[model samples]
Target: MGADLIVEVALRHDRSEWSRIVPELCGGDAELEALVRALLAHYDRPDSPLPEGPYPVTLGPFTLDRELGAGAHGKVYLARRASLDGFVALKLLRPGPGMSEFVEQVRREAGRARRIPSAHVVPVFDAGRIEGGPFYVEMAVCADPDEESPGSIRIGRSLREAQPGLDPGEAARLVEDLARAVHAAHRTGIVHGDVKPENVLLTPETHRVMLADFGIATSLAVSVAPESAPIGTVAYMAPEQWRDRRAPSPSSDVYTLGGTLYFLLSGVAPHAGREVGADAPPRPLPASVPPRLREIVQRALAPRPEDRPASAAALADELRRFRALEPTWHDRRSVSRRVLLFARRHARELAAVAVVLALLLPLFVAGYRFFAGRVGELAAGEARLHGRIQTLDRSRADLERDVARLEGAAESKQKELARTESRLQQLPRLEQALGAAKEEAARSEAALAQRDAEAREAALRVAALEAQVAAVREALADAQSRERAAREDGATREAVARQDAGRALGERDEARRRLSDAEARLRTLERELRERDAALAVARAAEREALRRAAALAPAPGTK
Candidate 1:
């Protein structure tokens, strides 16, 4: 049975009822039963002793130092390779029952991420399986460059965790940088199945974007599981992805990139805490967002995949163009000022053009008079020139329309700047509140650490008690066995003693009977001797007697 079933059973039932629960889930597999028990043991008490093997132990060439994070399938550890100089992130698939496929998944994650050679993508260094252990991938650790300390390691934080509420322009630039990285992945024939704020990492000082977590990366040509549940974050998922209708493509990544931008601008995801609707329109951006940026985001978050940007590269290009025009949008100069500046900057060129026109004026008059007689022949040429002038007029009108739109945008930008300044005015108060929150968080962390230490100690005590109880149980079992054997031995000895006593009694009775008969015979012989003496006495009295009887008895004795 799968370990998931065992875990589910353990969680669903009361802890006291696991005795009845896990055995059934294990299906009589002793190893599975023990494994689930160990898993639950560790789950309940992290400090509890593990089975025969655990991490912080060596796997192949890397010695796992500590667990950095864990997910359903595996754990990431900060590890040091024996032959390597720096630390690497080692992602190892957790070994358990029914996890054979997960091993291949980890291998594929490493393979796909390793193939995309982009600075924005976390580089995979190596991947292998430990003999009789687990599969692991070694990759470069993304750490905060700002927090770097000599002879110490720094862990990187994801963009959402580290920095939120970015300015609209910064958000656009960040997403643009990441889009280029996504484009690079697509070029390498890999589609990052999951792209959200969490997957994007930013180096603190430089704000460098590092797109990570290719664990769910799929082929650019087709999705590996198109009919499955949406493979990406729901808030940023494209409509087609939500429907699971087709393979995730570069356009899907662009859609998520737009969602990321939306989040940065509004401090909330585009569709946070909601399911994707079949006919949902793109959410309107905040008023503070520039029209150009909003347009870009809305286009990327199009309901139909085809309606969105064709590729991540195209999305990046749009953002690039927006950034290029951003300065002009922020410029507060009126149209008149721009015209005057243009004129001032080109005065020399304008003077040269005027001098050329002056030199050509007389020639033009002479030519017009000379050609007056041929005016009928030049009618077709004049009509062509008139058509060209009309086209130029239309072009000038279009330019005027563009200028008016830009003027409106510039006014909106000024209002946005005012709002920004007003927010900046409250910075000190916000900083104070932030300081208070950090202090409270520090206190909470300290309290939590104490509680954690106490919990660990309690776990140790409980484990000790359990060990003692087990020892007592074993001793009780041994004593009971000894007691049973002793009772059996005593009963056998009693039975033999009874048999011997009965035989001795019978022999004694026989001896007593024989003695009684011999005594009876002796008594009878005595009586006969006495009677013969009495008769001899009576015969002796008739004559001279008693003496005679005695003499007769003596003579008889002599004759005999």
Candidate 2:
């Protein structure tokens, strides 16, 4: 019988009842009976301590609900706090002879976590030893009611479960929060020796991330001797962390954070090596990840501690800037690269500006020409007015001369009349001459009035022309201003386009390099595959030859 079926049957009966029924179930087969008995013995063992099976109903102030997860150190359970209304994670330490150190470690973790007081760090509630049983610690549950528990899901699961992957910005933000928590611990002289995705907790409802499990954390102030083997997950540990056999520092945390980010982005650790080389290139990130972010991750994962960010806080700052699309320290270091990235990011805006400038170009030229034409017309009108003013002045001068001559003639006539008064015969002739001179003076006055009217008309025309000229000049200035602005905008667009082109070229070259590397790897794999195929073919032939020889050596069917 199958072990599962035997166990199922065995559970349904009491020990004495099962012992009598097992032989009948096995049907006198010794092997089957022995197998059933072995399975029964495992099920009936008094000290199995199965995490998913029977357990005490309560531990101190908490009532156990169900098992969340189990590890070598302990089994965590979803439990209701007797004193509180909310659910908490109750981790019950395994019972062992040398478990005092583990219990002390749990207490230390609780104390360290409580002291930090950061939202990103999971809070610890209480720790105590259950009477005649395992040691347990109650901590805040890091999960939502409808979502998978934090212990059930890890970074790899989060990535794999989602189609494609998490959004790059969201992943970066999550890691940034994690780094901030680590930084907070570092500031308090606490190093989270174990920094990996499995130890990071995520709240599904709030999407808030918290760093969990500081069991291996060490304080810099305390002079604890280094262990023979390095602590922390091997995949994320720094090279110096292992080679130097030293306690983890802020830099070690930084490396693991980078590895976490790498896993978030690419769904794999940066490298598999327990102690990666300083010069080893990090696994390439996906094309979706921004180059700046990828570079930041790579730098943080640098094998040498000194080569990485000085602290987790600095790494968090870089990630924050990346998420905000602001210039980072790396971008600030290279002006051309920064400009190129800016141009590429804002290409659409640049294109819109260029279109606007193009559309305004003809309007600007036409407006300029229209204003220039109006100005020329005003200038011509002004010149005509000046000429008319000169002509009016000449006419007025002529009229003044005639008026003076007429006055002179009238005075001469008056003198002649005075002399003629003595002689009665000359009296009629002087009266006629006076009438003629009077008519001549009236004509001269009319001519002067006409000239003055013409001059006044010319002055009015000049004033209107001056006003039109001023208006045209203002319009011309405005058009010139707009044209200059358009030109400047066009120049800027051109510069941006050139920069974008350069960036595109660089990206194409990068793509080609990657393709070449991929091709080289493909060739190597193909070679290995062909070698395996040949070996497989040779082995099959050798087997056939052996079979032929064996058949030939077999005795003739009837002769033996």
Candidate 3:
């Protein structure tokens, strides 16, 4: 009765252990829904029990104990590093359909994680492939991707949930911080190819942005199949990625940052379900955004890669400049606060310039008025000098009378006659001197004419000589060119008759080479023919001897 009852119960109950799981099944999410659908399809089979083993995997210094959670890529394990005596979250590659290469791949991701150098980037502590099996484990001693990151639980369960409620200023700061974090990764030869709110973690107290998941297809050095579709969250993907699936660059992260900010700044995702067509123009920023800030958001989200900021650093510089003039902009959040602080620091220097202008201008105006009053006092002295000069002019008549009395006492007329006679005697000497000057002038004029004639002749000769030299040089160049042609492929040579009438020779060149080659081939053929003749002569002589032997042996043949 026990055996019959057990068989009856097994047949009557559902095979998926569904009766034991009914409560959990009823609360199904997609992950649970997907899992149950898979199990229900195969539960009734009698031949295949659940496949089981150690399912061997290992992290850096620790071995994976057992499954903690089954995920899309593999199962997560709560692993402990034996060396450190610390627990780490490890993702173990499972062996099944299409999982052979996945183990090495997961280990490669973990290898990349160690290379990233930021406090924000999650550290990959250990990675190893299981011996004799296609499985690898990644040991990361960090927060779970499933749990809520700090400073964001106010929005909901995770950073992804909090993104939508972030105000314009907070959103801008977060986006800028993410840009900086991604740029830092790029500086170290890494690229956060996958950038979304979930990959960003904020510190609980400071709200400082932290970029997470450095090894999950986020490094520029990580190569993947271009046709395999970018292995990142779809909503934040740059439009260029959808068209070609090219490896991400700094600008690709820029586009994702813009997308994230767009969602945070406005409650709508820019193109949530649809990407801008590769040929379409970019969508505008939200109307509520300040014009200057909107321009930055639009430029980053441009559909074409060529249209976006060339680098994250370039975009950050542009944002800082724009934020300076944006009166409505909120500087209360993240990195934006630094820009405000910088302006505040320099404000005192600007205020000092203002205060100096106020004091100096009034003093300058008062000094100019005092100088004008002094110039008016000097005007009276000039009029007094003019009156004194007019009085002195009347005394000149008395001075003339004194001069006349002195001339009378000296007998002025006799003195004048004596002086005239002395001057007349020197006239003859002056005439002779004038005649000598005329002769010297005539000689100089004649010499100048002769020099002009000589100069004209010399100029003409120089011109003629230069023309002759140019012609000679042209001839020499042409002759050298022809000489080179004769040495090369030219068969016929035109002799350059030596202008100096010196040595000349005719050399056989291209034509002679052809003749020499032909004669050599003929000689080879003649030698071959002589060898053939000698062989023929020997064969004929042997034939003759064989005939004589045959004749001699004929009589013996008849006797036999």
Candidate 4:
């Protein structure tokens, strides 16, 4: 039957059978949903396979890697922070090309991104809309990077690929810190929808485990999903999550937490029982697991929800008590760790024979007695190293909390922001002033060009006027001589002709005075232009210096 047929038959059935199949039917597994819907639509028509999912999404500074795994909402990728070398898991929406719902989710995430401050919870770094879907970038974290069946970080290096050697004792501390991190989130009124071993990851150094994949996380106890119930990993699902359906609830997280611990301790999921849907309980790994821890694990894994620990806090607290006990498993892990290191360090001497001898039963006993002092030192070193790892975990947690708070403070820009913004407004105005100064300098240069043209024209006119005055003087001299000659002739003819010559001399004097006045005006105008050019040069130098200062202050955005 088609999935539509299956759903209609299953949901609208006589009430008794409806009760049986409903639990298995409703949940968000986006990848599975996409594939199943693709397959179901084609069962009658075998020409089609489910079309491949949408292409990889690139949102600003992050790149989505392959699908890490999926749940009720859908498949998620272990995203790398391409902007900064960090790790984050990105979850895409299920059942949509319509983006209003994705945008709604972005708004909810934007709010949580502003509010929460816990390291174990993957920090949401930035968000925006992308290609008919909404995507968010997050603070990337470290991972084992190769997970086949999901939720397994390799136990030893060769058994796991490129795994770092971390003291198991320290690894235990990290898990504890992760619990505290979730508890911190709970304090802020948020519930991580998915909490399981796969979601928990250690750093490159293996000092801490960061929580990932909050695709279905909710800030409120209520959210819009099918029937107000069953919106998380089924294997890790708490009974209340399935029964009453109040997820993002503490009880729901408590169920998942128990399931997580069960996977960690046993290396096989108690619910899945070594394979999907097996009835047998998986036995604990022989020497790797501590026994008393197993008893507490059994309590947390009780078939009924009410029978389990009330919250993650209680489960973490019980685990803490087990941690305080002196475990022979951790000691053995320490011994094996040293043997590897020793073999590597003293390769020239302990190359082939001693390594084989060390493995022998007699030398194993003899070597412990022989290198008793060295063993003691190595144990002390491991203890100190564990302390350093804890310190790093605390530091990382504090940094994440600080980042979350800063993102919140940035959104609504309070008093400090207002003051900073007021100062910042001056920057652009100053920049505009600098730009205007540059333009003014250019105008001044053009003005200088005009002034030079005017000066040249004035100088040419002065020269012309001087030439005209000289010509007039020459003509006046000729006229005076002629007048003198005329007077001479008149003396011979009639005696005094002085009035015409005196008038000609006076006109020549007037022309000389006018020429001197024009020269003086030209000198004054040239002097004024030179001063203006000097001032423009000074203004340009100041503007260049101001631009340099703005460049220095560019990257730091708010309150810097």
Candidate 5:
């Protein structure tokens, strides 16, 4: 079975429901059941393949390179427009039946989103449907181009995946930015049906969150039949959306923004791990979240849309208020810090005022004594004046000493200032030298990088040579084994040949001995015959010498 069915099911149903839903749909078909099991094993993997149609090489002026991400209705591609050096995200709706409404809604809402005056919203460049093909939207890629080379494509990581459990202040700031984007859309009568973390993309360098798939989700919600299943992400969908009780509104967007914030603050969705009924209370946020922010999120996640923020703008304002407390209301300095800062700003002026007050205090006392003398206590006034004079003299002496001490300190400070000025004068030369040093370091680093590259090349060559050597060793061992086997065979053959030769030699010796014995027997028989012939001749010589010749003649005649 093809994975298109599995991919469709995965895109449609929640993963938590796959266990029951897959078997129920498969209905005992082993192939689909096994495929579903395999898909479930790694469906959520980033590298999992979604069985989409063959990718188009070029759509209009855009040359498609590779897919960045996929969704229920469409897939986004990292593509290059004609003759452009930069890249843009090209979203193409999967060509199928019953998608014309979605295509129209997307074209309309994306146009509206294009007019939105918010920097946080991903900008749309163009959108149109082919006469007999898929609908397409060209938009600014919500990522830094430098993140991936021109040779490859990368989707910006979602907010939840990139920076889960963010600081409360950071979470608030991000949600506030999202709310502002939503508010911008709301102004144009476009309600973002889905505002989950997956729709929020973060730039690689600045990590600035930008809302993506702005009109796409709303288009999906509008185009999808209400009797089928509710639209939007379940984890962050508003209660009204879950119940299909009403159409998407700015308040529903506010609820999703709150859910996104909750996910950021606690690394989990507002519903926690499980889906909640429309009547059920939302799960509490993590305790570590700031109380004020928790309250803000809770209000945004309210089950009743009417009880939530009046609009996305209102939600943004609440988030702004919570964020303001981070750096303003709760960040106020203590009284002591305020005084210290005030003194630091007016140090010289305060010193002068203190000195003037100290000097005038003596004059004020003297004036009082003089007035008393005029008032008829002349003797007492005179004594008091003398005492006052003495006290004034003592105070004057103390003041003089303090002045002298201060003067010495001031002189030391002046010397220090002179030294600092002398150092300041060397700054230019130091900076020049520093610049030279930095240039030299950069050159050295470049050289080192080159050397490292060469070293890596050499290492790779060495590894290749080592692999060749290993192969050669294996071949040599095989050849050696063959040679050894050949040698053993040769030895066995030689031993057999030697044994055969020995047996042949023994047989020849025995035959030669038997022949000699036969020859001896023949010779013995010949000698015996000769002896008998001689005995017969001796016997006949006496009595039948004359008869021997006649008998021999007669026997010859008879035989003839």
Candidate 6:
């Protein structure tokens, strides 16, 4: 029998009737009759139980093609609108006793999402009741809905599937974008009561973040009533929010943003409690997060709302500055803190400056002493030259006195000879005596000639002494000029030394910072090692107990 004919006969007859009419339908063909009987028996059996919960074929104007995900109260489905050209994410509220209220909440969420105009906020297209079942809301899909095998695309899922947490810079940029979106909603008198990684979607191509799931968002213009309990994820909820169930505000959203950023940086939540103690320390961020950025996150996650940034926009601005390496509010507030942070960052440079200064100081001292000694030598040479010039002047004066004395003696002798010549004319008989007198006069002329030779020699000596004195004066002037030039050179060298010393001081500071960091790291490692050793001791004790138990339970001797 043909499959179509067998299916038709099985649908038309009951089990007992099919058993009785199979032979007649087959027309005496054994194989055809058996096949028809088997098909009839299979069609008579009851169908398997339907799969769980509101498996709708279509919702409103959209066809539910495949389930993207499901949660406690709702299920998200990949769907296509009847009149629309592209696919959309359709979230359906599960059918229950209080589904009407749930549907209204979803409508309110959609309204809130539609009011905000932000690229980071997911847009709601439409929402309505599904024929006779639960309600559905249509949203813009984050990824290519037509692509095959679209994997987990939410921020939480993506992070779980990756090896390391997101980079600090990238995480800051992403959170900044999200903060702007939250701020936009806040400006319209809306507060997203629940902001977490799971509700944040990511586009595959651009990796841009999109905020979704505003199920509990409240509008400040309408009411400020507190909920019975916290309305957001406990780990991400602000302390005041869960502690008193206070009305949600923009600051509460800022706390959640900080928690999300913490998750992105450390791959773990900052704290476990809904109402963590003020003194309780938060989980340390990874070393990858710079100190400035870490401080920003900590401030945003402050226990009290007043301690956090005033608004999500302000937080975004802080993160933007951090990403761009610009000084943040924390940095600008305290000069000392900024200097410390700078030193920590540039430790190596500061250390190098210190080394240079240490080396330059001694050289500067030695150069000063050397220049001082040269100046003293120049001063001493000037004093010696002055003394020599004074002595030469005294010698010239004494020679002039001796020449005057010699001229006086010669003039007196000439007068005496004139008187003797007049007396000899009166007495011509003593001619012989006149000859003797002439001889005496010739001896005196010889003596005068010798005295003139001595005078000429003394004049030459005085002239030579004057020339030596002049030369000494010129040498003294040159020495003074050289001393001035040396002093200037020393000043220049001192200036250069000071500059080098400054650079060295900077280097030394940098080195000290690096050493401090290294010591801190070593201390941390030691603490971790101690903890590991304690754990190992406990494990060894457990192993010993287990071995003893095993021995006690063993079969006696060789009784196997």
Q: What are the per-model C-alpha RMSD values against the true structure? A: 65.3, 54.2, 45.8, 42.7, 57.4, 47.6
True lDDT of residue 413, candidate 1: 36
How do the residues 63-180 of candidate 6 rate in per-residue lDDT, one tens digit apiece?
A: 7666766655567776778898666788775432323344555677778678887888878776656653455667877673324545433312232233164678878888899999
lDDT of 6 at 517: 46
Tens digit of lDDT per residue, candidate 2, span 344-388? 778899999999999999999999999999999999999999999
Can you give the lDDT of residue 377 in candidate 2? 100
lDDT (Cα) of model 6: 0.63
How does each model score on lDDT? Answer: 0.63, 0.64, 0.52, 0.51, 0.65, 0.63
Q: How many steric overlaps are in each model, in order?
A: 1, 0, 2, 9, 0, 17
* TM-score per candidate, chains pooled: 0.46, 0.53, 0.43, 0.39, 0.47, 0.47
Give a tens-digit lDDT track for model 1, residues 216-324: 4342112222345566667777778766545567778888888888777777777765554543555677798887688788888887888888888888888886776
lDDT per residue (tens digit) for residues 1-560 in model 5: 33335545554677788778777777778887876576456435544343343654766677787787777667788788887877888888654323555666677777888888888888877776543245677888876645447554445767867765468888788888888888888897777788898789877667678998877876766665554566677777787777764666788888889888878877777664435444445677778877667777777777887888888877878777665443222223356544554676678899999999999999999998988778777777789999999999999998777656545544453454354345335535634643564464445434434444334534454344345444544543453454345345434533443343334333444433543443464354345435543543343242232223222223222231
TM-score of 5: 0.47
Cα lDDT, model 2, residue 280: 52
lDDT of 4 by residue, 1-560 (tens): 23333434343455466445544553454554454344333332433222134645464455664555554444556565666554565655443222334445645665664466765666655444344233333444445544674544332111012223433344345556766766666767667776776667655534456676444345211333445546766566665554566555665666666666656554545456322544454455346555556566666666566777666676666666556643222223576655654565567676677677667968678777879988899999999999999999999998777555544433332333344335434534644654575475456434434444334434454344445444544543454454345334423321111222223233444433533443354344345435534544554554444333333323332321
Worst 10 residues of 3 by lDDT: 493-502
Worst 10 residues of 5 by lDDT: 549-558
User: Comparing candidate 3 with candidate 5, which one achieves the higher lDDT?
Assistant: 5
Clashing residue pairs found in predicted model 2: none
